[model samples]
Target chain A: MSMMKIGGWIKRILVLIFALVYLAPLYIAVVNAVKPYDEIIKSPLTLPKQFTLNNFVEAYQSSNMLELYKNSIVITVSSVALLILLTSMAAYIIARRKGKVYQMLYVFSLAGIMIPPVVTLIPSIKTLSALHLLYTMPGLLLFYAGTYFSTTIFLYVGFIKTIPASLDESAFIDGANPFTTFFRIIFPLIKPCTATAIIFLGMWIWNDFLNPMYILGFRGGKTITTGIYNAIGAYTSMWNLVFANVMLASLPIIILYLCMQKMFMQGLTSGAVKG
Target chain B: MKHNKLYDTLFLAPGFLVYIIFMIIPVIMCFLYSFTNWDGISASFRFIGLKNFVNLFQDASFFQALKVTLIIMVLTTLIYNILGIILAALLNDTGKLLGFSRSAIFIPTVLSAVVVAFIWSYVMQTNGGVINAIIEMFGGTKVDFYATPMTTIFMISGIICWNSLGFFVVIYISTLTTIPQEIYEACKVDGAGWFYRFFHITLPLLAPGITINCILSVAGGLKQYDHVKVITGGGPGGATQTVTLFGVEKAFEYNRRGYSSAAIIILFIIIVIFSIVQLAISKKHEVEY
Candidate 1:
C-alpha cells in the first residue's frame, strides 16, 4: 500500500511537469505578446518589465485581421452549412435504401476518404479556371464541398443508420414528401451527428492553410491562416509581433474549442476511430 | 414511394455533381497530367509519356524531398503513438487537474498549423530562444534546432507531433475506458505485477485503438506540408522539403505542372500503400477479446 501511494505521487508530479513543458510554447506566446521586442529578445522567460499592447495593435492593423476574420468566418460557415445540408440529405437516401445503385454510390463517396486533398488540388486549378471560378471564394467553397463530402457524409450515414426508419416512414404516411419528412423529422433526430460533423468540418475549414493559400490566392482574400502567415513572414524574427499575431489568429478557435471541449474531444475521436 | 426516384435524384445530384466535377475528375486529370510535359501555361503541350516521372527519379532535390518526407513520417508517427499511449495512461483517471491538463494538451491541436509553426519557430530559435535560453540558464549550452537540415527536419517532426499528440491520446483514453475492470482484478489475483498486467492485458486489449492511431498518425505525417512550409518554407537550400511542398513549388513556382502532378501521385500512392499495409498487419494481430 505504501509503495503504491509513493508510485502514485511520482506519477502525479511527473504529469504535472510534463503538462507544463507541453504548454510552455503557449505560455511563452502569451507572455511575450504583451512585451516589447527588446524585452522578448533579452529575457524571454521572465515577466515583462514593460508591458504594452503595441504588438497587438501593430499585428491587428498590419495583418488586416478584421478582413481575415470576415473571410474565414464566411468560408467556414458557408462550407460547413453546405456540407451538412447536401451530405446529410444524400446520406439519408444512402442509409435507408438497399439498392445496387445506392450501394455503389456509397462506396464511390467513401473513395474520397483516401484521396488526400493534395491530389485533387493541382488538377482542380485547371477545372476551376475552366469554370471561371479560380481564385474565387465560391471556387474554394465548391472545392471544400467536394473535398469534405466523404467524411461529412460518412458521419451522417452512420448516424442515420441507427435511427429507426419507421419514424420517417410514419411522417411519409402523414402526407409528407421526402424533403419535408427528412427536414422536419429525420434531421432533428440526427442532432448529435450534426454536432460531430460541424465540429470536425469547422475546425478543418477554419484552420486549413494550403488549400486557401493556393485556391483563394490574394485575388479573392486571405483567411486567418494565410493572413497570419504573410504577416509573420515579413518579420520572421520579430518574436513580439509573431507572438501577437499567433495569439490573435488562434484566439477564436481556442475559445471555441474550450467552450465545446467535450464535443470536440468526442466528435474528433469518434470520427477517426469509427471512420 | 411514388416519388422515391425523384427524391433520390434531388438529394444526391448536388453533392454528386460537385464531387464528380471537383473531386473525381480532378483526380483523374491529375493522373493524366502526370504523363504529359505540360508546363501549366501555353495551350500547346505534348504528352511525353512518363518523361516527367522519369525525370523525377533522376532529380536530386526530388529525392531529398522524398527522403525528408519519409523521415518525418516515421519519426512523427513513432512519437505520436509512443508518447500518446503514455500520456493517455497517465490522464485516464478522473481529477480536476487531470481534466485541466488534458484540455490544455489539446489546445494546440485546435490551433492552425501556421500559428503553431510561428510560435514554435520563435521558441526553438538558436539564439535567445526560450528553450535554449532556459537551458543556458540551467547551466547548459544552447542547442541550435537548425544546426543542419536533418536536425531541422527532426525538430519539425517534433513540432508536428506536438501539434496532434492530443488527438492520439484522446483516442487511446477513450479506448482505455472500454476495457473491463474485472480483467485487472483477475490479473492481480494471479500475482501479476503492474507491468505484466499492462503488457498482457491492457496492451493487447488496446489493439483496435492502436490500429486507428497508427493509420491516422501515418497519414497525417505523410500529408505534412503546412508546418514545414510555414517554419522553413522547405528552405535553407530546400533541404527540408516534403513531397507536397515539392509538388506545390514545382507546379506554382516553376510551372512544372506535369512533374508536380507526378510528385503528388507518388505521395498519394505512398499514403494508400501505408494505410492498407497497416490495416492488414493490425487485423492479423487484433485480439478477439
Candidate 2:
C-alpha cells in the first residue's frame, strides 16, 4: 500500500507536467493578448500588469467584423439546415426500404467519403464559373453540399437504421404518406443525429479558411476566418488589435462550444463512430 | 407502385443531383484534366497523356513536399495517439482532479486552427518572443526554433498536435470509460502492477481507439493544409510545403492546372492504399466487447 501511494504520487506529478506542456502556449497567448506590445516584447511570458481593450477595438474596426459575422452566420446556419434535411431524408429511405437500388445508392454515396476535397476543388472552379454562381453564397452552399454530403449521410444512415421500421409502417397504415411518415415520425426521432451533424458541420464551415478564401472570393465576401486573416495582415505590429481580432474571430464559436461542450464532443465522437 | 419508385427518385433527386454534379463529376473532371495540358485559364488544351505524372516524378519540389508531409504525418500521429491514450487513461478514472484536467486539456479543441497557429507563431518567435523570454528568465539561452528545416518541422508538428490532441484524447477517454472495471481488477489480482496492467490490459483494450486514431491521423495528416499553411505558408523556399500545398500552388499560382490535378490524384491513390493496409491490420485487432 505504501509503494502504491508512492506510485500514485509519481503518476500524478507526471500528468501535471504533461498537462502543463499542453496548456502553456494557450496561457502564453492569453497573457500576451492582454499585454501591451512593449510589455509582451519585454517580459513576454508574464501576466499583464496593465491590460487594455485597444486591440479588440482596432481588430474589430479593421476586420469589418460585423459583416464577416453576418456572412458566416448566414452560410453556416443555412447550409447546416439544408444538409440535415437532405441527408436525414435520404437516410430514412435507405434505412427503411428494401431494394438493390437503395443499397447501390447507399454504397455509391459512401464512396464520396474517400475522395479528398482537393480533387473536387480544382475542377469545380470551372464548373462554378460556368454556372454564374462563382463567388456567390448559393455556390458556396452547393460546394458544402457536395463536400459534406458523405459524412452527414453516414451519420444519419447509421442512426436511422436503429429506428424501427414499425414506426414508419404504423404511420403509413394510419394514412400518412412516405413524406408524412418521414417528417412527422422519423425526423423528430433523428434529432440527436441532426444535432450531431449540425455541430460538426457548423464548426467545419464556420472555421473553414482555405475553401472560402478561394471559392467565395475575398472581394465577394469574408467569413470570420478570412476576415481576421486579412485584419491581422494589415496591422501586423498592432498586437492589441491583433489579439482583439483573434478574439472577435474566435469568441463566438469558442463560447458556443464551451456552453455546449458535452453536445459538441458527443456530436464529434458520434459522427466519427457512425462514419 | 410506380409512384413509390418515383417518390424515391424524387426524394433522392435534389441531393443526388447536387452531389453528382458538383462532387462525382468534378473528381472525374480532375482525373481527366490530369491527362491533359490544360492551363487553368485556357478554354482549349490537348491531351498530353501521362506527361503530368512523368513531370511530377521528376520534380524535386514534389519530392520535398512529399518528404515534409511524410515527416509531419509520422510525428503528429505518434505524439497525438501514444500520448493521447496515456492522457486518457489517467483522466478516465473518476475524480474532481481528473475532471478538471480533462476539461483543461480539451480547451484547445474549441479554438480555430488558424488562431492556434497564430498564437504559436507569435510564441515561437525567435527574437523577443515569449518563449525566449521565459528561457532567459530560467538562465538558459534562447533557441531559434525556425533556424532549420527539422526544427521548423518539429515546431509545426507540435502545433498541429496541440490543435488536435484534444480530439484524440476525448475519443480515448470515452473508449476507456466503456471498458469494464473488472478487467483491470482481474489483471491486478494476477500481480500485474500499473505498468504491467497498462501493457497487458489497458493497451490491448484500447486497440480500437488506437486503430481509429491512426487511420484518422493518416487521412487527416496526409491532407493537412490549414495549420502548416497558416504557420509557414509552405515557406523557407517551399521546403515546408505539403503535397496539397504544392497542388494548390500549381493550380492557382503557377496555373499548371493539369499537373496539379496529377499531384492530387497521386495523393488520392496514396490515401486509398494507406487506408486499405491500415484497415486490414486494425480489423484483426479490434476486439468486440
Best by DockQ: 1
Per-residue lDDT over B1-289 for candidate 2, one digit per residue giving the tens place of the 0 to 100 score? 2237777776788888888988999999999999998999978999998999999999999999999888988999999998898888887766555665777688787777788888888888887777787798899999999998789989999888888898899888877777789998887788777888888778888888888889889888888888888878899999899999999999999999999999999999998998999999988987876
Clashing pairs in 2: A55-A240, A55-A241
Off by over 4 Å in 1: A1-3, B1-3
**Cα lDDT of model 2 overall?**
0.83
For model 1, how does the per-residue alpha-carbon lDDT over B1-289 read when each residue is reduced to its tens digit?
A: 4557888899999988998988899999999999988899878777899888889999999999999999999999899988888888899887777888899888888988999988888888888778888898899999989989999999999999889898899999988888899999998998999789878998898899999899988888888899999889999889999999999999999999999999999999999999899999998998886
Give the TM-score of chain B in candidate 2.
Answer: 0.96
Question: Would you estimate the TM-scores of all the predictions?
Answer: 0.98, 0.96
Residue by residue across A168-199, what tens digits does model 2's lDDT show?
76776788788887888888988998888888
- Looking at candidate 2 chain B, the ten consecutive residues that score lowest on lDDT are B1-10
Span of 10 residues, lowest total lDDT, candidate 2 chain A: A266-275
